[model samples]
Target chain A: EPEVTQTPSHQVTQMGQEVILRCVPISNHLYFYWYRQILGQKVEFLVSFYNNEISEKSEIFDDQFSVERPDGSNFTLKIRSTKLEDSAMYFCASTKGVSGGSSYEQYFGPGTRLTVT
Target chain B: AQSVTQPDIHITVSEGASLELRCNYSYGATPYLFWYVQSPGQGLQLLLKYFSGDTLVQGIKGFEAEFKRSQSSFNLRKPSVHWSDAAEYFCAVEDRGSTLGRLYFGRGTQLTVWP
Candidate 1:
């Protein structure tokens, strides 16, 4: 079963530094998403990307966050500046187009653990 | 303005005992509901989802969930739980009409299956 894959399983960075979390979604998937889960908190949606553009974003995805599909398979989330609160498990997910009335289930990657200090 | 509520923060059950996790949502129309599981330090895994007909949906790992539109709930259930079933379960919802496919997730219920 083709699954989403992310790089840098664990990352430690300074509080003010910039960081990029990379994901390679399933080859045929058209929609991609980024979600985060702070320790002991519910997974929160960050942003959704389609056609190489952002479709929607949450409040938490403020000025500091940006997503890019630099290549066909790579979907990357970039944080301009990190804060302690940015430390969390960042997950990447993707799914086929929403049609056919079939629920296009998003498949998640193993996640990249971001640790800011 | 959509949200999901998972009332139980943590639940414990003995091995081979039946299990059920409650989930409720606040949505105007028929919402797309989903259940996901996460083991400690792991990413989320889709357990099941409900889109339209046949309120009862079967999923992986011997799990099932029923969508009750009258109650605005989609609760996950299992005939018998194993020790390996211990994990954090999350309930999420997305408005069918929304184009972004952005999902709203609940706080989650941590299941502890005792041997």
Candidate 2:
């Protein structure tokens, strides 16, 4: 089965540095999303991207965060300034449809572990 | 605002034993419920989802979930769990009609299958 793929399985960056996490969603998927899981914490939604624009975002996705679909296959999340609290497992997910249809299942990638020091 | 609650933090069961993980949600309207599993250092894997129609939904890995609208719960169950079933389970909910759909996940429950 086709699955979402993320690059840089592990990322280590210094505080105040910029970091970009990349993901390649399923080829046919329309809706893409980013979520993060802090160590020992629940997975939290960061942002959702569709049609090259942000559909929804959480408080955690503040000024420092931005998402881009630079190409047809790549979806990237950029953090302007990294902090110690920014260290977490970042996951990318994609689904064929938006809502109330046959395709509601969101497939997730293996995730990229971000470690800030 | 929508939220999910997974009451159990950790559960231990012997191999070949039955397992059930509880999940409850707080949403104003009809909610789309889902169950996902995550192994160590891996991403979330969908087990099953309840969008509409049947209350009972069967998923992969010998897992199933029952959606109870009255109780606002969707609990995952496995008839016979093996040692490989040890992992973290999460329950998520999304609004049925929301345009900008985003899943709200629970804290998750860690299952440990003893041999």
Candidate 3:
């Protein structure tokens, strides 16, 4: 099966440094999303992207977070500044949108483990 | 707002035993429901999804789920579970009314299989 792929499986960064998590969603997917899970916590939605614009974002997706589809296959999430609480597993997901019949299942990536010290 | 609830925080079953994980959701109308599993240190793996048609939906890894609109529930069941099946299961829902594809996930239930 064609799956979403994320780069830098694990990352360690300083508290105030900026970090970019990269993801290459399925080639044909039109909708992309980013989610975060603090250790032992629920998977929280960060933002959803479509047509190069953000469709929706959660309260947690504040000023520090931004997502960009710089290229056809790359969807990247950048955190302007990191905090200790920012450490978590960041996941990238994509789906074929409603146009692809009824199969709107969002395929998830292995995830980028972001560790802020 | 759409939300998912996974009642059992943890479940333990012996190898070869039947397994069922409970999931409940609160939504205005029937929404897109899905079950995802995550092994330790791994990303989420979709197990099954329910989106109309046959109330019972079958998915990967020999797992199936039945959608019950009356109870507002989608429960995942496996006839037999192996040690490799141990993982954290998350129940997610998408509110088609708003937020086209944003998924709201439950806290998740950790499944532990004993040999």
Candidate 4:
């Protein structure tokens, strides 16, 4: 089965440095999403992207965070200034939207583990 | 506020034993429920989901879940589990109000299957 794929399975960066996490969602999928899981914490939604624009974002997705679909296949999340608290496992997911009466089942990538020091 | 609760933090079951992972949700409207599994070094994988009609929903890998609206619960079950079934399981509820479906996930339950 076709699946979402994320690059740099593990990322380590300095506290003040910028970091970009890359994902290639399933081809033919229309809606993409970003979610993060702090160690021992619940997975939290970060942002959702559709039609090259953000549909919704959470408080955690503040000024430092931004998402881009630079190409037809790539979805990227960039953090301008990373903090210690920014360290977490980031997952990318995509789904065929409610359009055409498709069920909203999000297919997830293996995730990129971000470690800020 | 929409929230998902997985009451069990961890569970251990012998191979071939039946298993059930509990999940509860607090949502205002008709809720969209889902169960996901994460193996070590892997991302969350969809196990099953509950949208509407026929409270009992069957999913991949011999797993199933029941959505009980009255109880506000969507619990995952496996009649007989294998060692490979050991993984972290998460329960989530979809936000209906958002144009893009946003998911609220639980803390997750870690399953350890003994050989």
TM-score of candidate 4 against the unseen true structure: 0.97
CAPRI classification of candidate 4: medium
Q: Is the docking of candidate 2 incorrect, acceptable, medium or high quality?
A: medium
TM-score of each: 0.94, 0.96, 0.93, 0.97
Tens-digit per-residue lDDT, B21-64, candidate 1: 99999998778899999897666889988888899999999999
Q: Which ten residues in a row have the lowest lDDT in candidate 4 chain A?
A: A96-105
Lowest summed-lDDT stretch of 10 residues in model 3 chain B? B94-103
Q: Give the better candidate number (3 or 4) by TM-score.
A: 4
Chain A TM-scores in order: 0.96, 0.97, 0.96, 0.96
Error of 2 at A63 (Å): 1.1
Ranking by lDDT: 4, 2, 1, 3
In candidate 1, which residue ranges exceed 4 Å CA deviation? Answer: none
- Looking at candidate 3, what TM-score does chain B attain? 0.96
lDDT, candidate 4, equals: 0.94
Query: What value does the lDDT take at residue B61 in candidate 1?
Result: 96
Clashes of each: 0, 0, 0, 0
Tens digits of lDDT, candidate 2, A1-117 = 898999899999999999999999999999999999999888899998889999888899999999999999999999999999999999999988757676668889999999999
Question: How much is the lDDT of residue A30 in candidate 2?
Answer: 91
| lDDT by candidate, in order shown | 0.91, 0.92, 0.90, 0.94
Docking model 3 quality class: medium
Q: Which of the numbered candidates is closest to the native, going by highest TM-score?
A: 4
Off by over 4 Å in 3: A99-101
